[model samples]
Target: MIAQRKDDHVQLAVEQQQQHSGRNQFDDVSFVHHALAGIDRPDVRLATSFAGLSWQAPLYINAMTGGSEKTGIINRDLGIAARETGVPIASGSMSAYFKDPDCADTFSVLRKENPDGFVLANVNATASVDRARRAVDLIRADALQIHVNTVQETVMPEGDRSFSSWVPQIEKIAAGVDVPVIVKEVGFGLSRETVRLLESLGVRAADLGGRGGTDFARIENGRRPLGDYAFLHGWGQSTAACLLDAQDAPIPVLASGGVRHPLDVARALALGASGVGVSGTFLRTLLDDGVAALIARISTWLDQLAALLTLLGARTPADLSRCDLLINGELRDFCADRGIDPRPFARRSGGLDVPHEMTGSTR
Candidate 1:
């Protein structure tokens, strides 16, 4: 039953990708071009550190699928892509393995395929400390992602109804787990309060899995007999809004959900994301084009990211924080309503003037 459900999730997620059409918050955030900048493409760096590990690229392949033979194949291909591209990869929820130990190989294949690369093990908030450790050991994960998906759970037909012990459970797991723990969201974005609360619980980082990528509510609703939950389709904060809300958070904030291309990744980095995760887009590419094609695509994204950084006058992903951004449209309205000041983002460059020669222009 669990394997079948995992298979269903893979199929539905693919369908969502094919049918996905709409503007996301990424469209609202634009970069301020600095023609006076003197930066070269070879000087741009994409390396980043998150969840207590160094990443070759700020972008990683986020959690997608595992647990069944078909999904296992997907994981294998994703693992190969991650290995070839030198970015981290996360497994889908390993709750299935705990239910039936026979399903362990499905999740373990990630480590089997990418033995030298960074891997993150995933579980829900309800998991016990023991299970969390087992999950990390199953994948030999460098870090663990404890996903808190209240919205996904509420919408899931067989999802958990109680949520009283989630915080305490997370605290316990974070305290007991040997590796760094990253509290993640499935699709619903985490707010400022939630990020602070996770920091308080001693979690290492927060993956703000903001809405706009894969819609779990729609997926679960599709599994139902009636499909009556269409109204809850766009129920949570978008990835851009969530990043704005998390500006004051002291812990490292990673961005996922709605991250489609290199420019979106650059936008997230400019907005203070320590790392970015791409799931639906990467999954669609691998499934549609094959592993070699996916590798080529990711490789191209890495090069494009470096080029984008150079264009924005930023030398590295972290330097993106210093690049000026124009936050307008719905995203600007979001910052206003959330009481987050958007002025600072616009003023990051401090209005410096560069010489004509430095700008590569002859006046």
Candidate 2:
């Protein structure tokens, strides 16, 4: 069963290679470019830290596939990319490993390849305290991501039905696990109320797995008789909308879902995300081109992001907070309805000064 699940995930990813609902809502976001940019290319910094660890890049490889030998190779190559780029990598749900201990190596290969690099283990929200601990142990993770895919599951023909125990189950896992716990969505973005609930349960961080990326619902629906779950195709909030809702969240927000471009990453950082996650794009890249090409692509992305930072007049990723950002179109409407002030984000660094002073010469 777990093997089939892995196969199904990979198959769906391939089949939907060119399929994106554009529901991630990134269209409504536009960055205010300051051509009076003073930052030099060398001065552009892309460093980001989370859970007490630092990485050369701000983006991490979000979860994708596991539990099968084919996926095991995928994890190996991803681990190599993480090690090469100094970015963290997360495994797909370890439920498969828990169900079949023999499959542990597939997930464990992440730790094997990137022993010193930051690694994250993932599991379902419905996981038991014991299962959570073991999942963490399975990969020697620095942190654990308990994925909450209530909607994703509802669409799957063989998905779980009972969700009443989610909160309690998550609370137990958060309290029991030795590592910091991060609650995540599978592609359907998370909201402020959900963030508040997770915070109440002691979760320190969340991945606002917003829409505008992969369509798991569509993937699951495809597995069915085509028209079974068609009515719910456009479900969930866009990644931009989800990020806006997370502004008031006490813990750090890690934006994921439909984050495909460096501009999207920049937009997410400006809104409220401490860091961003990219999965399908990276995975698809690796699949299309070998690991070396994938590594080169990540390097190009970082360079592009740094160059963008130079243009934004922000020295570092954190400095983007003080940079001018605009949320228009549907995203603005979302903030208006939610009572979130979009004006504050449109500042010369949110009124906070950048740590480094710029030279007098304007670029």
Candidate 3:
């Protein structure tokens, strides 16, 4: 039990780094401000549909916790916010709750609080199909999010190192559950090749929990003596880069990791993401100002998204995904090395607002 508490502290502390880590990798993405965007603000739609369920906004409260009684409060607060805003709320890994039946209520609280809103249940990629079904039943979740954290396992003291066998297990769970299945990278970003495999196996959506956010490597290093692993703290691909690589993927993607304000969210949407998951920011807000403050912060984030959409002349979240953006600096070089043409962006001094219609939607 003490070890669990330690794990919780380490997770919370590392997640707090999101407050300082600036998510802006590209210095040149800007929308052409439509001064004549005569559309009424209230008429703007921020609604989005993911895995067949419609959400009020594209901001989903990603998985957090369900191990102990204390976690109940955090889950409850986030669930309340989801219920109020009509967004989806995801519960943390249910493995711990499955091990200790007494802690079941810790996760069940999410469904209790948000009966009408969409709730997503989570489990490690290594869980068996039966366990995955139990986790879904525990949260009354609308979907299942299978999280893969390979590096985190390598650094974590008790983390499982043998996750290769979990692929078939994932297939079993995906086949058994009627709900949509989403495979997610815990912190390290997902590669295009890996995405292609999951698509072949019938996975519906993917979330790129990329680098530049609460690094699990740094967190694990903090809990133990640091050396080679410590040097690997900033090793993964940036969220922006990963987004570009996975933009043309077979399934829709959710841009996570290092996302802070609404501008970050808007930029992600413009980069071809169907939605943005706000986790660390919500965790910090809950810790500092309580549940009400978290809700207020989310409300502000949603409003900012609406304003950004208006500025970009996007009428809907789908439209935002099609909006054009400019790439520059190291990002431009990286894309060029991969045979992508950066000439259009280099010709422009700043970012140019390319209409999604003119550029043609990747979808």
Candidate 4:
């Protein structure tokens, strides 16, 4: 039990990093600056909406907590930040609520704090449909995030190691729920095949919680049996590769994992993510400095996002998806392994249709 609690806190700490420093995997691509004064920066609108909810910016607060007493305070602060920022916030796994009815308050505090703000409820893919359904109702969630983390589970001492037999479960949850269902990866990222599988389930969105941000395997290594298994820490997909795999996906993608700042948000939006999710960085701030600090930091991030979008000549999130980005080095090689022809960026033939909302324009 102590190990599980530690695991939970470690997970929260990782989310804190993602929200603060951000994962630096995908911001290398430069947005071509527009010198001509055709449009004023103030004229560019950064407002956008997703899943029937409006956001001042395209960045969403990803899932973070609710399994313990300590998380109650974390959720409270996080909730306050979300309400102030006007971005959708997702609650951590609601399994704890179902297991311990008394702990339901930890998860519900998010909705209670932000009555009108968008809140997404989450549950593991391995969880039963009834549990998933109950979680959605428990929080009156705007949407449901069914997270898949087979690799992470395998490594963790008390993690779930089930294979991909949750399709029927997911379909049942999706069919039963009125709100949109989003399937997400924990850290290892999703493949094109998995994205196709998710699309086939009629799911609406995917959060490619790719690697190079938080090392869950490494976290697990600290738990026990620290040997050859430690090498598994290097395993998993970078955020860039996951984005490329999910590009042209049937459903909109919510790029996540290592994203840290406005520039990362720009890169993700340009890569085709309808929006980006920041959990680690924000969680850290909430844990360390409290809600006020988190809000201030996120406000700065939003400002950076607005400035980036204006510089990219993107008037809105949709325009950010249409801008071009130059990919190179490890990211380019990662894309190639996944069958994406990076030559498009190299040949300047407009090879890849980089998501405009996330990337800066190169033209």
- Taken over the whole model, the C-alpha lDDT of each candidate is 0.90, 0.84, 0.76, 0.76
lDDT of model 4 at position 96: 77
For residues 45-85, write the lDDT of model 1, one tens digit per residue.
78998656799899899988788889889999998999999
Candidate maximizing TM-score: 1
Off by over 4 Å in 4: 2-8, 11-23, 50-54, 225-228, 343-363
How many backbone clashes does every candidate have?
0, 6, 0, 28
Instruction: Compare the candidates by lDDT and give the number of the best one.
Output: 1
* TM-scores of all predicted structures: 0.96, 0.93, 0.89, 0.88
Candidate 3, position 360, lDDT = 68
Expressed as tens digits, the lDDT of each residue in 1-363 for candidate 4 is: 632563566564655354444425585555544454123578777677655556677888888778677787688888889999888899987877777888888899999999999899998876777788789888899899999877777887777767767888887788778789999887788887888888888788888888856666766666666544677875778777788777778777788888767788888888777888987777776777878999999889888888877766677877776565678777777777777876454333233344676467675
**TM-score of decoy 4:** 0.88
Q: Clashing pairs in model 1? A: none
User: Where is model 3 more than 4 Å wrong at Cα?
Assistant: 2-15, 18-23, 26-28, 32-38, 225-228, 342-363
Candidate 2 clashes between residue pairs 3 or more apart in a chain or in different chains: 23-212, 24-211, 24-212, 322-349, 322-350, 323-349
How well is each residue in 1-363 modelled by candidate 3, as lDDT tens digits?
732653565365545554464635634455445454434577689988755667788889987776776677778888898887777888887888767888888889999999988889998878888888898998888899999888887887667889778778778888888788998886688877777877776788888888766777777666665445787676676677777777578888888887868888887887778888877778888877888898888888888889877766677887765555667777777676666664543232234456688656897
